[model samples]
Target: MPSTVPDSLDGWWCDSSTEYAFVGFSYEVTACQSRSTLNSEFKDIRETFDGRYVRLYGACDRTGFYDDVIDAAWNNGLGVHALIWFGFEGGSEWKDRRDNLIDTLWNNPKAKFVTRAVQFGSEPLYDYVLDPSDLAGNIWEFKWNIEDLGIPVTISELAYGYQVRGGAQIVLDSIDVLDAHILPYFSQTASTGDAAWKDVNNDLNWFIDHAAGRKIWFSQNGWPSTHYSGVEPNSPDAVADVDNEERYYKLLESKCEFFKSVAGGGVGWFWHIYADWQEPGYGLYAESGKTKFDFKPRTEC
Candidate 1:
């Protein structure tokens, strides 16, 4: 059977949980903030964005969280790339968690319909949570078991991780898709405006050259609308304020078009976030639930 996931890499990374205080890389996993809020966000995403796919960081467990997101996305005519959280302290339970998540989705008609792909984990190598060899083993096992579900499987990682690590190569070999996170903001010389577009394209090219012909999907990419310094001392500062955020979005949109023209398709790009949260200034929407940038790309292609 043909895959349900789109070939195009146009999507958004969405987080509905309000508990993302960013305390030690953790967040509360609620099914959703509220019914009305979830509904509105899904609707806006469907109507406003050109793409129909959204990537969620977690499968949201079996509670109201997973069901609500699936229901909202399906009702809004959107698809999801659901991720299974890996790399917890006692990571042995990941297999069980993965099984439960798949079973949950398989049983839920709405979730099964909206879910386009299953991403095994997000940035496992970057956090040093798992060794490359071990992660590859887990991915191989998960892919083998989940292939019967008829959904594509992949893992998310930094573009550089694949170049320098063993697990990334294993992941690339085992999965149907190549999901990478290319954030220009994390580069040594952080880029802004048009320069940002160039930086991202360079990153994209690097991945393309190294991906060994696998379909590439940018699982996360975006510029923060605040001036907050990143985790490391030399990290790039986020673009300050709403106006610059709009500029950053336009630049990225243009770059996406450029990529499609040159790369000949079979790639995907998702912005880092759908809305702002406790991370200070990374959201497209402010904490007040208002859009931070009223991005109106000139070439609406």
Candidate 2:
């Protein structure tokens, strides 16, 4: 693999082609998805959404990992934000998983070429798999292991994760970019109803202020399209319906430029999931491969 990336994320992620401000989505790949399916999916994202990147999970699929994901992304001209998902399992196995992926990357030259960045683990700190200091160590280890790769390194975390225990300065100080998964649905502000868009901006401003001068990029942010009911544990206003989802996207339209501006925040953002069939809910594309709403530059992700 070449040690240098030709079009590295040197400044900030940008895409003048899209009518939408968001540049990417969090797509989880699976073994059942064929090469053509992967190709079609990546092609659809680029052509349909004018999307420039995707934050990928499930690289370590239980059946077996797919190298085709990177190939499809490169073929579609979209950067891949690769990840080592440390899902809630608080065990020493996380380190082994990290090392295994590093070894895999060393063998897969295509991965190094198309990688936008190497995310050590998504929400490890948030999941309590590792505390701030331990997570920071893992980040540094991954950074050091891939030093020759010339890629930026980071970990995905909720905004409040950094503030845990009066701020996880060790972990916060480790990343090249502050990769966050800020969603209003999980916050108290979701009870505010029709003003969900305002909540998103307020949450955004909170990140901008607390970014510690590092570049900030939202790795995941989207409302669930599924409506709620009394049976659901969440309050009546907490669950998002189709109407609320549409409102959130539409209201966010005016602020797209600001969100993409380096002076405004630092980096671009990504919608949570790509398809409902793959992960269920939170998808721009429904189970039938149809769009769930009238969102532009993306009727479906």
Candidate 3:
């Protein structure tokens, strides 16, 4: 069958998430009140590169980062397709901040903020991670927040892992947008040349079959160019002898096909692209300023 990749992937993720997180949490993830990295990395890439969309979560305080990234993307022939913000603990604080942030972003003509916003970053797991009740509470709060925004809201990270049983039920009322968070293969399997790319493909199929009446996006999906714990490698280099370049291309091809056949058929979709991680080669560009393996994919045909 031919690939059914969405007519437009306009993928989105974060430079903040990648540069600052350490075993999943980075300084940038937590340090929302610091000086801006916006004018440099975020703005430069959004304007200079072919990057069409950029995702930002929380940081209502820095307002500058929000303005810079969106402004750069809008001014540079690109669009800030989504303005992703986070909700926490069913707290009124989160809702209050959500309103202020949305107002600030939308009010500024230079900011170019639209109703195209996402509610949670990784908040769905708030029950296990925070309060057991928070999982549902947060979702409800999100629905309210989205209704307030008068725009569609996406739950950016929906886990297939055990913590998210009844995953579809948990998010049904809270989100208009759903993304499958699938990360296949990592160090151990890839190092031994034993990893298969099938895991990611299977996860995509499982998500597609399960997510009905919901708009879907492979919100957090990709293979590490290298490897890490819990997340394995489906990289071409993992196989030593098979041409690495071809392997890389196949990986991208497969991902694009999955998005076409499965995700695009749903509601909306996005791919994760982190620009500044020097560790296991997870981005299209390395921190040292080189294209990781040269098989990078673009949004436009």
How would you encode candidate 3's per-residue C-alpha lDDT over 1-301 as one tens digit per residue?
0122123223423222121111111112234433355434544454444444444433455545555545544444343434334444454455555566566554655442322445454544533443434545665665564453344565555455423654545555455655556555332334322244565556656655655644455444444454446644445446432234235435544444334344324222233444434224445456677655544344321
After superposition, candidate 2 runs with Cα above 4 Å error = 1-20, 30-32, 62-66, 192-194, 227-235, 262-265, 298-301
Q: Give the TM-score of candidate 3.
A: 0.63
Candidate 3: where are CA atoms >4 Å away? 1-49, 57-63, 81-100, 109-115, 130-133, 146-148, 161-163, 186-196, 227-249, 254-258, 263-271, 277-280, 295-301
lDDT of each: 0.61, 0.69, 0.44
Residue-wise C-alpha lDDT for candidate 1, range 121-202, written one tens digit per residue: 7777776567777777877777676565666787777866766674366656667666778676667766454467667777
With a 3 Å backbone cut-off (N, CA, C), the pairs that clash in candidate 1 are: 9-268, 9-269, 31-65
Error of 3 at 88 (Å): 12
Candidate 2 residue lDDT tens string, 67-139: 6777787788888888887665455655666777677667666666677787777776666677677778878
Residue pairs of candidate 3 with colliding backbone atoms: 4-260, 5-260, 20-26, 21-25, 21-26, 185-232, 185-233, 186-231, 186-232, 186-233
Better of 1 and 3 by lDDT: 1
TM-score winner: 2
Model 3 poorest ten-residue lDDT run: 18-27
Clash pairs, model 2 backbone? none
